[model samples]
Target: MNHVLENPVYSALRTGDSHLAFGTERIKYFNEEVSPYVGFAHDDANGFADLYELLPEGRRVLYAKPIPAVIPQGWQLQHEIKGLQFVYEGSKNIEGDFSNIVSLADEHVDEMIELVKLTKPGPFGKRTIDFGYYHGIFDKGKLVAMTGQRLHAENYTELSAVCTHPDHLGKGYASALMQHQLQIILNHGQHPFLHVRDDNDRAIAVYERLGFKVSRPMNFYFMKRL
Candidate 1:
């Protein structure tokens, strides 16, 4: 699972719905929509079984391969390399004013995309907000930083899409938004988790400073028809 692919997959999960909807194809594991794709089928197996089973009759599985090997221990065998990062559960206090947090709507979609482009955080678009809540920081009516949630399992949600504009970096917006999201997850009675590339030392450091610990490294794979 190279960092590029790994990051987007996890981002999609975190910023999308609990069942993970990609383009259109929906995947069900244990009778739940866990993942989706534009051109893939929906089957249920350890590796590529779901994919194969969902394909049209006589249409061979194209992108069916194992995920990368560098995943966290708890999810190493799941065929998806993305793993989870856990923030300590007990401490749920946020130390900042959240009145400035703004919710984005249809009219603000273009602005949100531009913000994501400037920050280079991860894959985010208009649909990203459809899955989870997104909050942003504004300085004099200009969007500067933002964070959101994604990927919902039984008792957990992935805290992700944390990014701040370069010009506004070091202004504590990331920390503030993170705290806000963490508190939201706690209110829902779920633990917060996230994933980061191993080479992103700076972001990792910041998360650590915020009391988040790396649970394990995950991997991702892309399978195409052969």
Candidate 2:
């Protein structure tokens, strides 16, 4: 049987993040300001046509799936990314030194965006923090490293925006922050999962060490309504 993770974004919108979703029941998407992701309730390629009808021209969106999708016409394909999805399978909570970590709030959104720009950890926007549970490491009052939750699909929560400042690399900040997230999600009776570019060896290694097993390969389509 196919699993929920195979269509994670759709699963998330239908379940955990339903409040942030909008669109026809068959074709749903997050608020553009929060994320550029869209999903279909079923694997039918015709769902893309439903999304195209719902979105305005030039509206950008990303579609991800465990298997490659056949792009229907009426959309401009900007690019594609090969990705890997991982899910935490460890039995115990991760332990870490979280002394330097601080919970980020509305006041920190600007800093968070700036950090995201510098580190390029993935698609992050002003209201993305509304996903909640954002925590960061500070150095002399400057936000340097952070990780947060996204795409909560029922019992699973995605660990996203796991990035550290270039100058702060090798200090274990990324690992520490992820471990903190892992502990929190596991404690809440939810499993943690995330997607990283297939070429991101460093991140893949860190996740493996943290007990996240590679669940599947994914295809990411970045496109816009035509």
Candidate 3:
């Protein structure tokens, strides 16, 4: 497979148009109340320099880097790099049985909050839900696995917030939900991409087996909050 195909982060950076950086892409949001930049590189040389220059003097730019490989010079290794993969499906074929969790006009917000908590709870997750468009897996009337989309840049839509409850894992729930979401995104004439830690061998293997490829190594830099 091609290098970019092996590392989705690089693909996102090269393909995204709203913002530009060394190895990261900008997922623009409509809300002016929020910070303009959401996702940053874990080991982005040019991006880090740009961000550092943009920060106000004496103020720190706090963030995390998901490094795909060795630490680049001038960058302090804060944490281990994680595997990042990309999957593209021309047409989604959702198999098995999985119920979709709809967030109507009135229920969307609360459902989103709950879904974020159930997934990865953090500022990133918050930013994701704020962009809306999330789906959940229902088990006996309870929300289980969920897959959603975020960060729209032209014809590219990122497939994110894919999570399954611990007790509900190993049941093919995540793959099914993701396939469903991928189909929807493709139907809109857009491609799908996502990020995963490099050390996540199991997840990486699963994605590769499902036709996803390791596009390129991406770095997630985690700066100390000021």
Top of the candidates by lDDT: 2
RMSD of each: 8.2, 1.3, 5.8
On a 0 to 100 scale, what is the lDDT of residue 224 in model 2? 85
lDDT of 1 at 67: 45
Cα lDDT listed for each candidate: 0.56, 0.90, 0.52
Error of 1 at 169 (Å): 0.4
Report the lDDT of model 2 for residue 105.
Answer: 96
Candidate 1 minimal-lDDT segment of 10 residues: 29-38
- Rank order (by TM-score, best first): 2, 1, 3
Please write out the lDDT profile of model 2 over residues 1-226, one tens digit for every residue.
2388988999998999999999977789998879999998655758998888899999999999877877779988898999999988875746677888899999999999999999887899999998889999999989999999999998889999999999999999999999899889989989889999999999999999888898999899999898
Off by over 4 Å in 1: 1-26, 29-49, 52-84, 222-226
Question: Which lDDT tens digits does candidate 1 get at residues 125-223?
Answer: 556665567788889888788888755544566776788888988778888898888888888887677766556777887788877876545543323
| Candidate 3 lDDT over residue span 87-149, tens digit each | 564335534454554442334445655755766522233344544456776778777767676
Q: How close is every model to the real structure, measured as TM-score?
A: 0.67, 0.96, 0.63
Candidate 2 C-alpha RMSD relative to the actual structure: 1.3
